[model samples]
Target: MRFIKRLIIGFVMVIILGICLYCYARLIEPNMLLKKSYSVTVPKDVKELKIVFFTDTHFGKYYPQEKITRLVDFINEQKPDVVIFGGDLIDSYNRDQELVNIEELSKSLKKIKASYGKIAVYGNHDYGGGAEPIYEKVMTDGGFKILRDSELTLSDLNLSIIGYDDYLLGSVDPNRYQLPDAPFRIVVTHEPDVIDNIKANGSLLVLAGHSHGGQVTIPFMKGVLRPGAEKYIKGQYDLKETITGCDATMIVSEGIGMTLKPFRFLNPPNIVVVSLKHK
Candidate 1:
């Protein structure tokens, strides 16, 4: 009887500790910035291109406009040639109150400066009922051009950025957007699952968000509750034939905010800065 009581007490203590740790990680740690750096080899003649990418800013009770300001500040500091947003700019799911002040969010996002341009795509959360149009307006007002299953080329930079709509809420016709031959080709999608559907058309890099790194992951076991994440969740992936037989690298961002429940454990938010250089 004494041993059984001790075991039960130990179990309770572990649960309590887990709750405390989860609260801190979910609330405090998610707000912190994590800068991730990577280098991709491009053509020899192409000059090095710096890219700053972030995504999944739920911009609701979990993520506020203040965080957007901080993110913009950090992005400007990077002095990227191109800035790209993966998506999920808002969160208004069955809530009577507003998630974030749209005007302030727009203003803060506009503060981000890039040499080529600042681009964005829509995410699943952005299409929640009546919030889709509002989110699009915010993105446009903030100077972010939404790329919905389209391609934009920078003649001077000799680079192309391909934007795909949210896999869950929007249609994805990879054949519609052909990857123009360029020194660097980048594809941005809201969810990493799109990688499986689209054949790589000479794209060098693919960037995605929506998984939020499982939002609540444990070590070794992989993200058990990753809704948006299909086969790939977080970090980098080397694909051989996933994209039209051409090899490509796919990067999935952990994202800066939370959804459903404002709780994160083990996984933290991140900002990715990818530098394209000569081999």
Candidate 2:
């Protein structure tokens, strides 16, 4: 009888400890930022451009306005030449919780300074729960140009940026936009799965954010898989090789917010800074 009682007590303690750890990871750890830098060749002859990219600010239940303000401040401090937002600006999934203050969020985001310009794309969460228009409005109001299945060229610098829509929600067709002859060409999308379908004639770099790094990763165990992000979870990958006569690379950000159960373990939020140079 005494041994059985001890076993039950131990089980109860374990459960309690698990609960505490989960809470810390979901709430406290979500606010922590993991900043990383990378250097890539973009085929341009101009000076190196510093690009700061981040995404998935699910601004509702767990994430709030203050977090975004702080994030904007941090990005500004980086003095990025071009700022890219990967998408999912609003957490409109939870019907129980009130929506994030879109106006305030837009105001906060507008403070971010990028010398070249600020570009944005949409994620699956932005389209989920019928919040697409609201999210778009917020981004536009904040001075972010929404790029959807389109291409923008910086004529002066000989750089071209193509924006592919979300894989599930918007158009994922890479065939629509032809790769320009610019020395530097980039593709920005919300889903990293599109990297598989990209057919490029020149050196191309694609940036995306949707997986949130599985949002909850455990050692030796797989993280939660979302629909479109089942393949690329986090970090960078080489989609094509020069050995194959083509060069392309893709970067999938872990993102800054959470969804569904609101928990993250081992996978913290990320702010990626990439420097582009001539090959």
Candidate 3:
């Protein structure tokens, strides 16, 4: 009799603990935002630059558009010289159209001030769910220049920013166009795994967001990794031996929103701020 009673109590305790974890993952963790920072060495002649990168705000059923206001404020506080968005802006444009207010979203995005410019690249989600038609417009409306398999040169800084198309849904050919003889280069993509395919020479820094740092991470076991984010889950990776064959560093942001499961465990949403200084 006592053994059965103890078993029942243990079962009840397990059930209660599960409920508490569920609530924390679904409610508390997802709402928390963290700011992560890193520093990179550039040529001494090049001017110092501060770049703020954020991405994967699914912004549909799980993430609200209003949060962008707070995000913009947070980014502005950093006073970044260049602002780069890694993509996955809207979760599902088809289903979330009603939930997102275009004008408000654009206004908030515009308010995010960056002296150099705001650049963006496409994510798988941006090309999927009927978002292609309006993704460019939305981002452009918000003062972002979309780089699809293209390169942008910042003459004064002697820097080149190359953005590739979504690896899964869009076309990506980093070598399609010849990059200028810029001393510093920054590559932005939605998926970090694609970095191995990039062949940029010289000092390089890559920024990506898609894994969400295993949105629902567990203590001992691995967290969920999306299709394109299999190899590089999150955080920084020194890719000196990568296919790029150049000395390079990559920083993958955990991102600012939730997706498929609508829950965030050990990993909280985050924006990455990178400082580029003379070597």
* lDDT by candidate, in order shown: 0.80, 0.80, 0.88
- Each candidate's root-mean-square deviation in Å? 2.3, 2.6, 1.7
Poorest 10 consecutive residues by lDDT, candidate 1: 91-100
Q: Which residue pairs clash within candidate 2?
A: none
Per-residue lDDT for 39 in model 1? 85
Return the lDDT, model 1, position 164.
91
Tens-place lDDT digits, model 1, residues 1-279: 999999999999999998888778777777778898988877765567899999988777776656777888888999999999998877663451455677877788888999988899988887874577687888889988899998887777777788998878887775754555544578899989777765544437889988888887767867644555868988999876676656689889988887778877776778999999876
Which runs in model 3 stand beyond 4 Å of their true positions?
177-182
For candidate 1, the per-residue lDDT at 56 reads 89
lDDT tens digits, residues 158-228, model 2? 67788878889876665754554444478898888766665557577789888888888878875997777
lDDT for predicted candidate 2 compared with the true structure: 0.80
Best by TM-score: 3
What is the clash count for each candidate, in the order shown?
Answer: 2, 0, 0
For candidate 2, the per-residue lDDT at 165 reads 83
Angstrom error at residue 259, model 2? 0.6
At residue 114, candidate 2 shows an lDDT of: 92
Please give the RMSD of candidate 1 to the true structure.
Answer: 2.3
Best candidate, lDDT = 3
